[model samples]
Target: MTSPSHHAPGAEHLLTRVGEVLKPALTHYLDLHAHPEVSGAEARTADRFGRRLAAAGCELTHEVGGHGVVGVLRNGDGPRVWLRAELDALPMRERTGLPYASRDDAMHACGHDLHLAAAAGAADLLARLSDRWRGTLLVVGQPAEETLTGAGAMLRDGLYERFGRPDVVLAQHAAPMPSGTVAHAADRVPMAAAGAVLDVVLHGRGGHVATPHLAVDPVVTAAAVVTRLQNVVARETAPADQVTLTVGTVRAGTAANVIPDHAVLGIAVRAAGEASLDRALAAVRRIVRAESAAAGAPREPEVTVASRSAALLCDPHTTGSVRRAHTGLLGPARVLSWPGSMATEDFPLFGDAGAAIHGERGIPLVYWMLGVADPDAWHRTTSDGITSDGAASGAPDAAPPPAPNHSPHFAPHIGSALRPAIAALTVAALDRFAVT
Candidate 1:
């Protein structure tokens, strides 16, 4: 791996420009956090991001695949480096209590708002230092990432064909770790999980609740299925194989006095490999069918696989290069090795994994986790202190753990996190771009 001292001559200028663009980047983060849109409905978010890219002198294109935005910056061609960030938010409410927190039903609970601002800041800095580097820059705002569908959607819509295939794709995600730090996977797989989302409908006969003997209740069957799903991971899956099955949503009757004709369930499964994921999915289908049969329902249960994606694996060579660049920019202490996670992502589709959609392969991808937690707040919660119950303790605060991704309380310390994130992206892209 290359050392920080061996960075190109332009690296110092890139770091200096990060401070110059911090103010507006923070303003953008605040605005995005206050107003967020959910998956497949990111018109406003896309527009805001597109305008930022345009202001940074990128030739912009909109609506590549369901509100996806693409911006191109060419400074004499060398390596085409793509910096990708998510545009859509989660379908949940924010409870961070920040003055600029989302007031609507949707929330940027996953730090996508932070990601966008950082990408925009990097775009501005890179464009300003255009003469120092030679290459094309592709800044992409992808939508529907919460549903794990946006990357595939964009690829299917000819992301590479229309905008030109990239030599490398770089992305970063916000994590609960302390601010001013970045973590890269130590293994080949950055995210070691493949997942599938399932939608199920249970059918039965409806009648008055008083005449329970005459009516079949699908709600009962749905409950049974949910209970049995736990056994799939606990008893069926190998202990070494990491797997999780969750019934996220369940809807049944309208009135308590009346039995509903059907009940619906939204199921999600994640596993370390495709075979484990397949087995878990199969088990889910079997449990649903058997429960419906046991309930003596008039019709069989319906099951549909809503979305799925393969495990995300980073290009080892590319990742090592970027990791070294990050070390050069942020110092060795701030750059850490990441233990592979079970979090699933559709980002794999942007590389060789989605050869079926893009008809191309060998596009290197580099992803790292950006720390977003406030150092003081994080230390307060993690330090040994008196327990809430008035007892002395040596353990971290247990009353309220640090809010993680997808949590209603998840909030990034923008002041400390934003600049590092921008610098991380800028250095990684600069490392790939030819030094003029």
Candidate 2:
């Protein structure tokens, strides 16, 4: 639906229009934020999104790939453009004090509130601007991103098969940066690839705390394994190759007197590319089992990978289009060309099969980054609040986003973050579809 314009005409009119159309979408976005559903389980959320898209004139599909939703709008034939919105929320408690903050443990702390809203807004805007261009417009509301299964699930469930693949694949992330600033890096390394969650179980006999010598302490063995796991990255990976092996969680003995019979360690491995990822995973398991055995534990540690993802390789053409779009919409100075993130994104897998399609046919697939950092208001809101643990330590503010995207407190100025994202999505789709 269209709305009135307030600012002066021209670019301001366009901006105002985008915001106006996005108001309801923003409300929906906030509503989704207040009631976030977790990954592999976005049934209700998916239904809500489907209704909205269907109401907005998108041909809707539900449960496409375990709670995934797809909305297709076919305009006069041109180049096909695909816009992706992640529907899953992280398994984090809402810490943002916004009135619309998520009431559930699953919160849109990753700015996905804005992501999905922008997708909705983009769909609405593109529908309105249908006279401009396009072969087809596909708005994808992918689920289960937290577990990195949604995108892969969509492809497996025939995302491309059911709905022909696009000539250009474009998706924008809402940055927490200053208002009106849009940044894009061309053919730069997109998000780094990641491997499955590694669950390691170390088995040993339990004994009394005072008579520790009498029992095979799994805790001690697990501790040794944790300390030595660092060597997988330090000693095994090449010095030049970027690889990270972190044993983030460990569970063992409950009481000081009794040694537990079993020890468990959870790890996440990040690699610059697939080769390094495979190498690191192999080394990590080998070390875990060896360390357990050497620590006098008769049972070997069991290593298992729960999920995996390939690195995000930015399609050169798509990256170039994003760069030009940013340069055109926001200007050169406002466009910060930084390196891509090491974090993982399932988006890259869409083009991985190398199928005969648009992006496969040589259209560049670009993932644009919206700056969500360096701004004072956003920084303070997202990075300043202290956690319950930090509050106990007498600090009330949270630590700055060690990075963006998965932090529970990573909040963005939605009003400011939304405009550029909408404009970028709208402009990118139009630009690509207008090509060829």
Candidate 3:
């Protein structure tokens, strides 16, 4: 939930000095939120970020990985700290009735719009206060993160070779937590998870519904596959291993009177470790193929792991430094060390204290959670004890709990999330890029 109109902790002077940037950041945020773009198609989004970065005193480079934007600020070059923001939105409809709600089919349900504006605001603040620290601050707007391909695409396109790897990489994600607060998971592996997009297609012979056994029902096979894969995580995986298997969609027949020739299903698999992920995926393949074969499908079913999200690991040193800095700024109460979730993110591709791109390790990654929920909404959920996923934990609930990321109803409290987010990034950079 939104705080009572607060300034960032221990950053009153700097916040005032760079206060002008927040207005433009708000404008940028609204603009981004209102006109969303999908992954790999963020051309205009890249342009918007590029302009903002340039205004923030960053040297801009475009098209690193399809429309990725890189903004570099060199100040006597001590440590190279990289701050990244996602440049893409989801393909969900914007149901929020705010005046600035997106009119397009796409939506910023994940709060990337806020993250982009925050990165811009931080760049502006750092550039204005150039005397505070000495380092090369690299601000990057990464594309295709929703599809879990942006980081890999950027890496393959010389992201490190051309720009050089960072000494420390920092990022943040918008969470359903109370606005004006932040969360970290330093003790546990913060946000380290492997995820994959699984797509399956089953081929079968079609026949009229009147036929008894004339058709090899791929729909039945798909149903069996879906039902069987549910046990991959619960029954197969070790109790300690965290894993999730979700069958998002399944499509098959055209009508109740006719059996379709083929069926398709989309699945998502994620886990904190590679072994858990591997086991789940293996189970998926086994179940899908086995079900299809048993149903006497026309041919071998198509199973694809469309995308594999990189597992992210935060460096203890870098994460600790950020934790300390944020704790000092926002206080220990506002800054919490929360547990990690199964949700996947592409930010992990940056590596943990090393060069994950070039095979040699060099850079460390640290990503924290920024609360964007409206104060009233978050409090309503807390008072009523809402589930972590923003679902009401109790029955007979008045309404579904506060919306979380990816939900069409998600509307971050930009007024409260923006300033603190900017401050958090600015302070994190200042902490790592200490005055030389």
Candidate 4:
């Protein structure tokens, strides 16, 4: 029941043929990048993938949870494997000075473009290898990864109920690390649990500049709450456990003379464990209430927490498979330890409880950091060569490449950085599914 077009000439030929196959894909992918779309608003993007996957003879389901797409390919009675790629773009203005850099309001700063291309390329490769593999292949194009809502929404909307859950789920993210390097560890926690929002509006009386104690002064209370919230991480939790409490934004009075009637406090929290997170939230509530009361505020502050993401755990079995596959193909030098990260990914919600909470079903999350930053310059500056002044490596003339991730001027070495990633993930998928 397979298409004659799916009969690829040679699986080994993919290594050499990848470039030609990817050229058109890369163009299309970059075009999508140019006109990036945000989460829940990816109708056009999802439609594009729907057509692309259908043309390749893969079964397609569109509009899953707003703008998500799933492509299914069944090959006899082999194990079911799930491969995912995020389709949404960030709200960032493009700064990468490339000919194909994003021109639209939204940008692909996180390299989801690479992820989408790799998934499609893998689909093409696996479609060709259908004769060699068994079981079902589910390639998912998920949306709203940046907003941390897409995956969770899809699951809630019956992704497993409709498509049937996979025995093994695999997803890869493009990182700003080294080009040829892959990061993996047996017990890897690629991202932590995170929550953020603007809440806790403090009410007070506005007064004239000459007023001494007429105004409640919510701004003063907010400043105190910010200082006290830090104690939650410092005093409540153990020194070793990682937790973060930050006040990113605060808004209050307009005039210096008059005391403002109201002020708003924005809070953000991150933790590695659920228990710790609960404790952190409790502490936030306690601080807001007590501080407002102390400030002699009349009414209770309205508190609300908006965005939330659970901690990401890498399944040992899958992580081990990825490590073995990566090391076997790229060698130990290129496969480095999974450098710990404070950032968070919502991918953890994919795993069911008691799945290993840390095991493959438990972790099912393997995040590899692809070294995209210039290694030569990094090595020189990091080494004990020059002072902190103008010169490191005793070479004041040397300067590092543009900053990586979140920097306005950051640029990726597309050919060197992206090609190796495609190769690594392709080989890793083949290894995981025993396709080759």
Give the candidate number with the greatest lDDT.
1
Q: 342-400, model 3: which lDDT tens digit per residue?
A: 88888877874224565647577889888787767666654464344333455564545
Better of 1 and 3 by TM-score: 1
Those runs of model 4 whose alpha carbons end farther than 4 Å from true positions after fitting are: 1-14, 103-105, 188-198, 205-214, 251-261, 353-365, 374-398, 434-436
TM-score list, all predictions: 0.94, 0.86, 0.92, 0.82
Which model, 2 or 3, shows the larger lDDT? 3
Write candidate 1's Cα lDDT for 1-436 as tens digits: 2222226455545566798889989988999999999999999999999988998999999999899999999998688989999999998988999999999999999999999999999999899878767889999999999899999999889899999989899999998877877888765654547999999999999999989889999999899999999999999999998899999999999999999999999998998888999999999999999999999999988999999988888999878888888888878877877777777888889988899999989999899988888766665664563233212243644345468889999999887899888988998988888886
RMSD (Cα, Å) of model 2: 6.4
Candidate 1 ranges beyond 4 A from true positions: 1-15, 384-399
Highest TM-score against the true fold, candidate: 1
**Residue 80 deviation, candidate 1, in Å?**
0.4
Clashing pairs in 1: none
Candidate 4, residues 267-322: lDDT per residue as tens digits?
77877776777788888998898998998888988888666776667777667766
* Model 1 clashing-pair count: 0
Q: What lDDT does the true structure give each of the candidates?
A: 0.87, 0.72, 0.82, 0.68
Per-residue alpha-carbon lDDT of candidate 2 for residues 95-174, written as tens digits (9 for 90 to 100): 76778787777888777767787788888887887665647888899998777778878877888879886666777675
Backbone clashes, each candidate: 0, 17, 12, 13
lDDT of 1: 0.87
